[model samples]
Target: MWNHTEVTKKLSIKFPIIQAGMAGGITTPELVAAVSNAGGLGMLGAGYMTPEQLESDIQKIIKLTSKPFGVNLFVPENPVVIQEEIERANQLLEPIRQRLGIKKKSHLPQINTSVFDEQIQIVLKYEVPVCSFTFGIPPRETIHQLKKNGIVTIGTATTVKEAIMNEEAGMDMVVVQGSEAGGHRGSFAEPFDDSMIGTMALIPQVADHVSIPIIAAGGIMDGRGVFAALILGAEAVQMGTAFVTCVESGANELHKKAILNGTEEQTVITSAFSGKPARGLKNEFIVKMKEHEDSLPAYPIQNMLTQDIRSEAAKQKKSEWMSLWCGQNPRLSKHLHAAELIEMITNQIEEIINKFHLIKETERLI
Candidate 1:
């Protein structure tokens, strides 16, 4: 039997499941709306979009579903770029660029101006029901403003200390992203390497430490994983890899095929594609960039530099060159509609619960 929890009640969602906001153009309005319409909380990945794009997508999602949805923003990082490091990375990339038939000087791509404040303004203008953030905690003033506008706030954390920090900052809930999760690690308080806590270990510890509801995220691809997370004290499970195979997913055909055919052992946590460490399928691009990993420029810089190459690769359907971000268990991802996927997961959880009850009853009879 499904049970309503603090997360479900607070979010006004029928199910205690949230489709992970897999940013970088992967979380399209269609996917978000489908998930919301299916009774799960769907979130728009606003982390990579311009304020204008975010506003348009927000409006689109609203048009499609009356259910409450959330937007996730990346906490900006303005790291000082060591010119020498960038230069070395460029030299390392020159050979690959030549291999890909591109001849260009090693120079940083101009970054699009960050519209964080404007994006926040858009969220408030729409009265978006929820806002979640990763990479780092939002400024207290920002949090305060959102709360004043009646937006339910969530913060992503990679450690127990970070969860406590989120609670202290007055967030409505916390998403504890474990080490096995795809995409970027949400570690900000310390070096990310040291913060690699797994879901099984992290959820219970975070639950014990924070007063707010805990949402578990990582290698959770099925209902069994959701059942396990709830038992470990999570109020809900946030899944990204599983949703990548959904019919409404924004992943390319190659991305979907690669994910379905891939395995946990095929993934590696690398900063080659983007300057920050994110888990993705190991391809020739990732393999060649390994040597220059330490010298790559910080995010937004290296990420911008490689944008054209990635785009061209995608145009050519070169999976090897695509980011292909995925969690540990890619094989478990199913190709289903978002609504159908939710129903399948719900049934799986119900079956698990029923089996447990039957086992207990039989034990009592004995």
Candidate 2:
């Protein structure tokens, strides 16, 4: 009964658990299908994928499973490009690139303003079951178009005001990403630093403000976190760090190892890798860039400049220069099959419920 909620009915999934759609190759087709087949919703992190790449992955997922899956896209941002800033960021990263033996310089990033639109068309063409947006809410027309096609639209938010914006835009559900969330901060309405509310506090506040279903994300790693979110007024939970170490995850081995071996105090939020603030293990690159983070070009720009360093570092087995994105609850991470992870969480939830019921029965007898 705990797993049965509005999210389950609307998403048409057996369990209320949804794997966080982590971009940068973490949510592979196999992982997505495995999660969906295991009774929870699996999502493809298509934010960084090309339109063609998105279509190809969708086809692959279709062959792997008939169960419903979701695709997450990053809402396009139009930051003012500063050539001077780009040069400075590149200058700061040159030493790392040299250390990794990367000979070629990274070119200026090309901003694809129409990529989101093209991705939407792909989703419509394939009739994907669910589409979620991060960084910001999509246009009202975009939400309307997705809803018109019967595709569930979920928006990410870090504050109550952002949740209300998603509802006004007609989002079917809103994922309130707490400050404890890994990867990029989905705080679009205000400065991310001011929007860093924890999952426990953000869920109930957003629930009180918005009538749409709330999917709590951030520091949610197991059944205890899931049950806690539901009790905090969330209809469901989205987990990222818990899935990053799964066997099916496409994350780099070193990245997985860093998280597995990482402690709760090791992770920090930095915008050096990408023009946006994200939580990950503090490494040499992060430390070197800390002083210059505020001066770097806005995301996608800064993200482009550091691409070579991250890629080469991974190839050379140097995690010190790589981005090991993780949440505050890294100690709870486990390496297992996606299905096994789902089953474990489910069993844990069931045991917790049974224990509570036993307690209630004993109290009644007394």
Candidate 3:
């Protein structure tokens, strides 16, 4: 069957569809368990979770389902803390903060370089079936440790060079995130702008260069996308925006409604929210900060700086100020149960296969 592939065999899942482990509460235990229970690999977006929170969620997911699931982590990046940049970024954000009634300036964030190690230990302790990383590949020793424990390791890449780097570092699979993908850009080896290859182009080129399995992401929302990814040499596809609208997703109702009502032209890639370039709905926060993006603090710093504004915006039901992350194919999004979405995808694939067979028989008769 088309669903059975190297990814399915390696991950021990029934289908090659892997739910993107979106961070910031989108991948709730209930959502993860539901997808895994339905035969797709469900993942917990544990990028921002504390070690304690990770362990608790793992326990909760275990109670919800016996099927395999995965956790996605942000491979730590320690950028130099530039005090001037923080003050400048804050100066730009002050107006929005005041509008949201956020009185206190967000404290200078303490960068914890040890969080990744602690997270690795939690995965090891629980023997989580799969562990994936974004931002960049983890240390070789970390990959070796996961493999030694019989846990599968996956990495994200935006360019073919990055994909090869993941394979060289011993990753079992690499998710080739196209520029159209939602959330953060995973380009590490070069500038993200130069690595913005679309899904159709990136998948085949990376497949030729890397021996490990490839998981195609970005702008893929249905079985048609899954079918095309397989044809392009990807063994599976990872979907994030598709799942963000699922009934069980932990995304705020406003976020979900925005995506459902959004058009393809509405999404834009901006670093205004997290200091990392991510695609999402263009809004007041993004537009107002466009001029200041070049000076913003890197990643965790800017991400920490904006925490209060985002949280307050969500609480106040202000979608314009929130980080409304979405892919390029928002028009294809549907509000369905996770299981129903999976089922619809599988059924759609089956219909396409049948139509292809019918065409072949017609050609034979002619």
lDDT of 1 by residue, 220-322 (tens): 9888998899999999889999998899988887888888999989999999887999998889999988987887999967887787678778887877888
Which residues of candidate 1, in runs, are more than 4 Å off? 103-114, 358-366
Better of 1 and 2 by lDDT: 2
Deviation from truth (RMSD, Å), model 2: 2.4
Candidate 2 residue-wise lDDT at 345: 94
Off by over 4 Å in 3: 358-366
Where does model 2 exceed 4 Å of error? 358-366
Could you give candidate 3's per-residue lDDT for residues 1-366 as a string of tens digits?
Answer: 788799999999998999999999999999999999999999999999999999999999999999999999999989999999998989899999999999978478688889999999999999999999998999999999999999999999999899999999999999999988988878889998899999999999998999999999998999999989999999999999999999999999999999999899999989999999999999999999998899999998999999999999999999989999999999999999999999999988988988887444445688
Tell me the number of clashing residue pairs for each predicted model. 0, 1, 0
RMSD to the true structure for each prediction, in A, is 2.9, 2.4, 2.6
TM-score of each: 0.95, 0.97, 0.97
In angstroms, how far off is 353's CA in candidate 1?
1.0
At residue 165, what lDDT does model 2 achieve? 96
lDDT of 2 by residue, 111-226 (tens): 98799999999999999999999999888999999999999999999999999999999999999989998888689999888998988889999999999999999999998999
